[model samples]
Target: MQLLRSIGFFHGNILLFCVTTGAGIFVSPKGVLKYSSLNIAVSLSIWAACAVLTIISALSLAELGTTFPRSGAPYYFLKRSLGSSVAFLSLWIKFFIYPLGIATQSLIISTYIIQPFYTRCPAPELPKKCLALAILWSLGLLNTRGVLTVAWFQTISVLMKITILCFISLTGIVLLGTGKKENVAKFENSFDAELPGASQIAEALLQGLFAYSGTSILINIAGEIKNPGENIPKALITVLPMVAVVYILVNISYLAVLTPQEIISADAVAVTWMDKVRLPFIFGSIAISLFLILTPMIHSPKVEYIYGFIFIFSGLLGYRLHVHLNQRSVCFDKITCYLQLLFNVSPPEDQDEGISTGKKHLEEIFL
Candidate 1:
């Protein structure tokens, strides 16, 4: 069946926002600070620079997406611009990378969630993995329903996450305004201690880039978008800068409450920020709620990994079954045909026709 085209401009924007801003924002600041050697100014500057680079990348990709919007976007673009072989390899690599990336992010979320609850001992890894798996499967099942359901979930969750970040930022402002001046002076003195070298800056910029990694996801689902050409570009331009601003403000908020060193040492920066600001009881509850809301949205893209494996395995099994059946004598040709039809061992004629049409359109636009 053809995919439904129900995602509009607003929904598209929220999907991009949620994907881009996700768990990275809550966790990356600590790595940024560590990479920058606890220099708040340097880390924030890296974040700003990466944001600009991400926007530039999004704009270029947006133009490409508008011109030739399709599912399997990266593979489609590669196949058209380069060749089929390159595209095939890209698809294979993506299949491997998707699961690994999802598992890592899910584990990070679980770790952060349990960190605050740990009193003496550290958070256990077995529970973390179980929690991560639970999140992955839950979201995967949710996505199987329809893209519209996923869009609504993304919209609400992203807004809640943004609100939580804003609340944390405001709390930072309050703390900075009322807290003693000595702490600020001490932080300033440390900021000016020694500038990081080029290598260190580059490493820190990588962390910032990781936080901004999901901007291109809009292109991946372009086939389902209501107005692929108009909505794709609009969402990229509108949501990216907002994501950047939120990232910067969140970092600034972290600095507002704790010194650069404290942020660098923080295991979970957002949780630490709440704890240090002395709002653990109030903001802590809100932050936990935000994370729970954030989980499904962040885990949505990862659902593609599960589907990817299913498609790959099914195709392989069908091909092997077909080959086995083909080896039989000519008298069995009728039976082989029946089995092929029953098991769907070959691609449907209409699907090939649709793919040809899509390729022709892409060629007309690009060639």
Candidate 2:
């Protein structure tokens, strides 16, 4: 019952969106360049492949989720299928690797906020580490509340981030169509300098995998699902494509606006690309990025608390409902027994136990 409460109604789509879109675009460009010389075509191909692998992994996870459909979730599946040591290692890696990535991304996002104001501020500014710690703690507080609100918040943040990207893409398109010297051809020779070699392809693939790492979060909450078999699969099948498209378009927009060298020269993607945009895009990007930075912080603690609270509330709610239902059942049984008595008919055997119990409880209350 507790597990049901914790996992209930959190379908695969919701989880897929949360995990897939979490920190990918914010961090992937750096990862992509470190592996490749930031070749646009190669980067796109690697990212596309990563999305494919994610979908494949998600399908496999769906099978596991449906078969087990319990609270232990992925841990249970891995433990049963692969053995405990492997399962523990996977779980441990998931806890640190992903969350650390998320924490880092938040700091990256927050850096944009601070960077713009660094010189203007009175005493220079606080250290980057301090800002990162603040964001993490703030997010932890928000996530401690529970899952339902966190789900809704994530959906909204993704929309805002996607909308901003769309705006940038559209602006670039308009700039090109109007013959405004959009410089799309500047990077024509981006590959001429040094294209990625075979080893880099493998490395790019790994980085892309890291970018697309959170695809299985829904499976983590499978036990709480109302109908695990149906809902979990439906959500995953529908959500992954949307995430993949957004990721591709956003990265392309980055490349479109600035050449490979331009993207690679800067240390931070948001700061570099944002500075190039018109005021609307610059301020809008800042505003939108700020919102996204807060999104994870807000949702993280809420999700944690939600599942935590469910552990407490499920048993209590179930017990209360059970008692209430049993009481009502007895009342109905007594009324049926009276009708039988009046009609000179024999009442069901079960009526005796129910009526007697209800009578005893009612008498005790009255006394």
Candidate 3:
């Protein structure tokens, strides 16, 4: 059965907003800071650069979604332009990655919730994992209920998260106005520090991009939107920029209140921000209520990237071999083209040469 187009531009806004502005904002500053050599100027520039990249990526995906007008997501595109085996391999890798993603998010959320309780020490792995599992089950059940239900839940949760972020941003502004200028603004010597290596710059960009990684969320569900042509681009173009702005403001707040070294040292930047602001003890309770996130499986920061790189490299190699082995048919008229391609079957009626635009199709993973 096909999905109902219950998701209008309004709901699309929520899903896209919530998907991109996830917990990576609060925790990922740590990774970005370390990689950017703890220079406030370099870090903010990286954040802005990542935001631009995300916007470009989202716009490109919007074009693809409208052109295809299908909910088949990446697999559909790959199969049509590339071939079926490549698409199958994408699905195969996702089977494992999705669960890993869920667990990672749950772990990060649980870590933030549990950290406040252990003020003197890091929370134990047992409790964090247990809480994460509970959260995982709850999310699994939530998904089973329906898309609308999840959308409503996301709407409510995202509002609270935004409120908290605004409050933090305001606090930073107040601090700046009250002569906390040193911490509030530190751009004078931003790039004067020794430059980070190429790898470090790349890693910093990766960490910053994670906060905006859900650019494809709407595209993946394009068929469920009321009018993919108008609504998809409208939502992505409008929502992602606002998310990027909020993230930059929140990071400014983070920098305003905490020293570079302190930000680097903190495990959960949001929790630390709360403590620095001297918010009531109840703030911790509230944060646990408002926040949910994902962390890497191995816990160390770099290990997660390593695992991701390995999987991505494997997938690319497999795709190359698969595409090489299964060369697409020279002609597809009166033939079922690439269900194997998507819901389309070329009928030898049009002037379009192929689903793939050229004699030699180059693989370009833009995002």
Q: Which candidate has the top score in TM-score?
A: 3
Please, what are the lDDT tens digits per residue for candidate 2 over residues 1-367? 3654444444345556666765557667767866786666668777888889888998898888789887668899778889999999988887888667877777666666566654333222356668778878877887787766666766677677667657766665654555544556644555565588888888888877876777677667776677888887888778887778777767766776677676766555656666676577577799999897678767675677568668989978866775656535555556655565569676447988867865665565445
Better of 1 and 3 by TM-score: 3
> What RMSD does model 2 have?
26.8
How many pairs of residues collide in model 2?
17
TM-score of each: 0.73, 0.67, 0.74
Model 1 over residues 1-367: C-alpha lDDT tens digits? 7777789998998899888877888878888888887777788888999999999999998877787777667778889899999999988998898888788788888988888887345688898899999989988998998889998999898878888888877766666677668435645655576678889888888888988988888888888898899999989989999889888888878888777777776667777777776555677799899888678657775776678779999988866766756544443555544565478676546988856754654555446
lDDT of 3 by residue, 324-357 (tens): 7774444442233333346644444443755354
Q: Give residue 171's error in model 1 in angstroms.
A: 1.3
| Candidate 2: residue 36 Cα off by (Å) | 2.6
For lDDT, candidate 2 versus 3, the one ahead is 3
What local lDDT score does residue 67 receive in model 1, on the 0 to 100 scale?
78
Cα RMSD (Å) per model? 26.3, 26.8, 28.6
lDDT of all the models against the reference? 0.80, 0.70, 0.80
